[model samples]
Target: DYHLLGGGDSKEVYVGWNHVQQIEIAWNQIVYYEDDEKLFTEEATLLKSLNHERIIKCCHYWFDSESKILNTITELFSSGSLKKYIHNGVGVDLVSIKNWGRQILQGLCFLHSQSPKIIHRDIKCDNVFVASDGKQFGLAVCIMDGDFVKEKEPKCTPEFMAPMCLLEMVTGEYPYMKCSNQMHIFKKVYTGVKPVSLGNVKDYRVRDIIEKCILPMSVRPSAEELLKDPFFLYNGRSSTFETCAPVDNILTSRAMNIKHLYLV
Candidate 1:
């Protein structure tokens, strides 16, 4: 049986067994609008065609014409989203954070490298999933029908939006969290002010990455370029077992010592 995972305005996520193997899927029940159907179909097709290690895998999809419901089967990350992972205060060392950032950037690079160039307009912590093995998985919400154009004023969570989308408005509040309204948030975004979260980040490299992502549309670094940044590099050495063994042993010994002290 499929158990409820969570839901948003458009769809619900569920976890269940795929015959013998356990799997998770997202199910969207279309309201039967012709345009909505077309858009959903297109998104399904696009998702199926996309295959990348950092991007969520869409295994299959089925549409029930009679019920007007669309079902999409995707890989389930039991560890949940990055936002939740951080909030839980689990495995959040600098190394893990950097690894997650690199993976996310790689996923973005793949999408942007596509022939038509898919822009993940909504890039936020909540949209990034974490696997048990500490890998990051990005959720892509495709923007259809020229929504990126200025006239449409695409709807997005202000906190995660790029500054160009907000017309360079600067704000002291974190993106979207402090704004009284969308227009207020828009003005703040237009002024090119850094979000409160970015301002509070103590790590220069992490802060730099966030700044690059929210730069004015014309000058923002592409995901490909961001991948090449020194922040992702690790002392020009492979992170192989031989290189990490000594450090790992030290850490393990320290942990054991702490445990023994506590027991005593």
Candidate 2:
């Protein structure tokens, strides 16, 4: 049996424990209230076809006719989502951040390079997961259904959305939010008005990368192109680790301390 981990939209996530191997696994269950069988089938097919180190692995899947529920078992990452990690204030070094950005871009490149090409409409920190050792990252969930792809309008968070997507949403459309409608947001984005938070970023390299990602869709660089950017060329080794004492000294320090006792 699996314990409920968390849930979102119409899906529930569970953590399963294997007594024999003493390991844990993650199961994503999507419950259908309506008779949308095609959606479930397509999602399953897409998940099964995807295989990448930076994308969560879907090992097995099954459907329960009685409950109208679809379940998929995938690898369980211990650190959970990247959004939570950043909010917790652990303070990741620049090297690790660059590595993470590179990994994410690699995953995106793989998806976009496919025959039909998969556009992850919802690419945000919340959907990115971290491994137990914190050395790896993976994209958690995606919407691969035909409706989202053909609709042309993006269904994603406003903050992470590119200006092109925002324009599409407000084109010949009325306001959605009261205080700030889609048009207002689109105007700000289209006119080159950046978010206040962006100015707070001290690193020009990081800021430039972020700016490139939000450019008009017509000019926005593809994932493969961005992978070759100079920003990702920085060696991921931290100066702090490089300046650490030699491995032999670190391993033999305790033995050397006890040597004086024996000599006395």
Candidate 3:
């Protein structure tokens, strides 16, 4: 039986078994304008074509004319979102951080290498999920709200942290969560002011990476370049996940949580 899962904006999610496919899938049901249904379905098609391991797989989709709803069937990620681990009050070690960072960067690389290039306007821990296999994949991607704009602009969750979401991973908190409002964060970002949480990142390498990521767009490293950085090159083994901490013990099936971004 399908069970209600958390959702954001006009979308709702449910997890249940697909009898025909004989698999568990996360169903994303999004409400769209009747006239704009084509646009939404096209976005779903794009998702279905993606084959990267770090990107969520959209099995198929269908639109209900009378209900003005678009339903997308995707592989279920039972471990939940990265946001859950960060705020779970459990400590995460550097090895876990590095792996997550590298995976996300890989996902970005694949998306950007597309014919016309695809940019996930929204990249936050909430949109990144950990699969049962222990790899994190990007979700709530591409047409986040079923709307596309020719001119690129900042369209992310109001609480989105721009430094590849690495800062939040390191500090275990969201950047600018202290800011009074969205405008306040925009003003700071426009003026090149970083969240004070940047100081909380103890590792110099992690701090340096975050700083470089937050630099002016002109000087920021491409996903490929970032992956080649020294931080991810190290081969040191860590016992963090080997010990199976509460953060790594994600065995139970959980519903996918999707948070919609507010268009800027």
Candidate 4:
């Protein structure tokens, strides 16, 4: 019901790609069916006012008191969510996942940077959509399911829960002692120091930012904070995202040169 409007329930996506040109979403929850239509119209109108690449752009909306229905439309993405792709024997690889992680952060950064600010509380693989060519290897994660997103105090998910969650759960003391929800986890992670339980992502850049994003706020990382992140580096026959690929010999040369330079 909620997902289809703009981002229909995760299960509803792809039910009928051709049936609708754009999906509508409500800015707030609808407790009454009578108000559902109006909610979609109003929220869609608001979202349409903003612009960003990763966000599923809202198109238009209208109120139909006669039919007791509200209408809103948005860009139609034929490709489905990353969750859908993962369900069909295509688990996101390290490279693609890293790119996705980067893009998700980018989208969040864009929203959080807004004058008022917007936060996608439910950030997960299922909520993220892929382009129609989602299978095309190299596209970053596309954020969808904005209906559940909020501009103020946000709702947070437990899974994909940031590290501070684990830390607070484990340590359970001041600072994070009262922490709850995943965003708190992210806030703690933004500090730069690693949260105890997390492991490293394969991509150096991604891993670094994840650590940065989760870094405690005292040392928060910004979107402009650049690391040596690779876009698409290839070596031999297999791409980096590929499961099997040859290692580059040049790394040894570079390492040796650095060693000599340091010694001097």
- Tell me how far the alpha carbon of residue 34 in candidate 2 is from the true structure, in angstroms, after superposition: 4.4
What candidate 2 gets wrong by more than 4 Å, as runs, is 18-22, 143-149, 163-192, 236-264
How good is model 1 by TM-score?
Answer: 0.74
Q: Candidate 3: lDDT over CA atoms?
A: 0.68
1-264: candidate 3 lDDT, tens digit per residue: 799776667777899798987888888787778877766666667778888888888888888889878888888878788877555654577787788889898988887787657766456776788777655565546344454443434444434534548876776556676788889988887788888878777666677888888887678888789999988777355533211112333222112111222222
> Which ten residues in a row are the worst by lDDT in model 1?
250-259
lDDT of 4: 0.39
Per model, state how many residue pairs clash.
11, 0, 0, 15
* Deviation from native of the Cα of residue 222 in model 4, angstroms: 2.9
Candidate 2, residue 208: Cα displacement in angstroms equals: 1.6
Residue 145, candidate 4: alpha-carbon lDDT = 28
Tell me the spans in candidate 4 whose CA falls farther than 4 Å from its real position: 1-42, 64-70, 135-154, 158-207, 226-264
Report the CA-based lDDT of candidate 2 relative to the real structure: 0.57
Ordered from best to worst lDDT, the candidate numbers read 3, 2, 1, 4
lDDT (Cα, 0-100) at 242 in candidate 2:
13
TM-score of each: 0.74, 0.74, 0.84, 0.50
Worst 10 residues of 4 by lDDT: 250-259
- Per-residue alpha-carbon lDDT of model 2 for 1-264, expressed as tens digits? 888887655667789976666878887776654465666666666777889999887877877878877778888887976655554445445576577778888887887766666656445555678899877899764422212322434334444455221111111111122226656665665576666445444555666776787776678887788779887877545521111111121110000110011100
RMSD of each: 13.7, 16.6, 5.5, 14.0
User: lDDT of each prediction vs. the true structure?
Assistant: 0.53, 0.57, 0.68, 0.39
